[model samples]
Target: MDATTGINIAKVVGPSVSIATAGAILSISALYTPLLSNSARSQSSSKPSPTVTLPSIRFIFSRGSHFFPQAATFAAANFGYLAYYSANTAVKVLGMEMGTRTGFVAAAVLSIAIGPITGLMLPVCNNPLREMAELERQGRGDEVDEGELKKMVKRFEWLNYVRGAAILAGGVLGLAVVIAEGK
Candidate 1:
């Protein structure tokens, strides 16, 4: 491809990747929101007798919450693929400068890393929800171990923040690519 064509492709995909990265960051923030955590806590606290079956975890929190992070992961992955392509185009096709090339490379690497890291942590993060669902199925949600739940919440929070930071870093690197392309 010509330099102009490669530059144009980088220009187009850069903004798209930025937006998706932003969305992923926002969604990750929501996953650890106080309100959601409070809701889960309240639901757990208000459970009926140990013998009575409680509603599934799916019912406790908004079902949409469960799917949002997954969608964010998909979006992150899409951004990674596009960023990788754009970085390649910028470096190989467009013959961008060393600094510019390095930025794109960093962006591409971060984006690529973000998707899998988030995907892997997602299940680990959602383990509590899954456990709650199983507890409900067993009619023993009231018996949930608070210590374990707290530990799970802490793990989820920190891991998700790490994922969000990865996206933020990726977004910044993408901006670097945009700036370099403008030169």
Candidate 2:
């Protein structure tokens, strides 16, 4: 390869790979640890505890705030990078050359799907915090409904998995394509 080509590869592929890898690590970490889903359980109990399970709700909510936002940031970055690569691809194809960017259009769309997932994630993360705070204000923490709380937390946790997988898939695929093209 020419020197300029090598430089371009280094500039684009190097940071893209690093960012993708870092985002994947963060996402997987959040999935395995309580960083996103409060439970280490392989599965939520088949029977959600009876009544307003305040402690469970609080646990997930507190921990959701702790790690989800950064994960969300990574999700955004994954989408942003995919969009960047897709733009490059579109331009190349339009120029009548096969894009050296190679692949990841589907991954890009999946990353965009994160938009709506995060849309759902917002309320799941925030509503609980607000509700809990309001409860504390009114001295009714016990009033949080277990069933509803479980549903909300489930949605939050499920959304995390969906986005995490998207981020990881998009990132890995992007890195692989860039590296292969670089080669």
Candidate 3:
């Protein structure tokens, strides 16, 4: 391929693939949220429904925090730059075909919408879990209620559903753009 063909391919393919990848990762991760509960209904209210112990829960919480930030950092940053470049460079500099240009321009807006939402929402959901994890680590696990934690896990799953839907929608839309552009 010539230099122009390479740049055009990068402009269209890079952002589309990035969004699809991010969406797939988030969606797959969401599937495991139910496991966090590990609920086995009890005969009596005295026993907590979720059997995952506090220490185990804390471990998961600690590990879970680590995963998103890394993904958000690398994936979000990489896509942000690519989509920005695609939208700007493809239309203004590269002068991509009208179909490809429209697709790239639309993708520039659609692709990164999840980053800000996740950025704002994750801390909201994670703060309580973080505090509970820290307390569990410091031998205050007794104070951390597993029932509340279960509720939070449910909320996490719900949040992930919403986020996953949005991100996956972007990915699907990006795929549509790819098809529309015939690239």
- lDDT of predicted model 2: 0.50
> Which ranges of candidate 3 are over 4 A from the true structure?
1-30, 39-102
Give the residue spans of candidate 2 off by over 4 A. 1-98, 101-113, 123-129
- Report lDDT per candidate: 0.53, 0.50, 0.53
TM-score of each: 0.58, 0.50, 0.62
Instruction: Report the number of backbone clashes for model 3.
Output: 0
Indicate the TM-score of model 1.
0.58
In the range 1-183, model 1's lDDT, one tens digit per residue, is 875676566555654555565565556446543333334545655322222212422442346356534544543454454445554434322344454445655665565565676567658856565666578677776677544554554555566667666656766666656766565
The worst-scoring run of ten residues by lDDT in candidate 2 lies at 33-42
Q: What is the C-alpha RMSD of each candidate to the true structure, in Å?
A: 6.5, 7.1, 5.9
How many collisions per candidate? 0, 1, 0
Which predicted model would earn the best TM-score? Answer: 3
Task: Tell me the tens digit of each residue's lDDT in model 3 across 1-183.
Answer: 765565556545544554555665465446555555654444334333333444555665567457644543443343344444443322222334444445544544445555666666568765676676678778776787877877766666676556655555554544554454443
Q: Residue 7: error of model 1 in Å?
A: 4.1
Pick out the ten consecutive residues of candidate 3 with the lowest summed lDDT: 87-96
Candidate 1: clashing pairs of residues: none
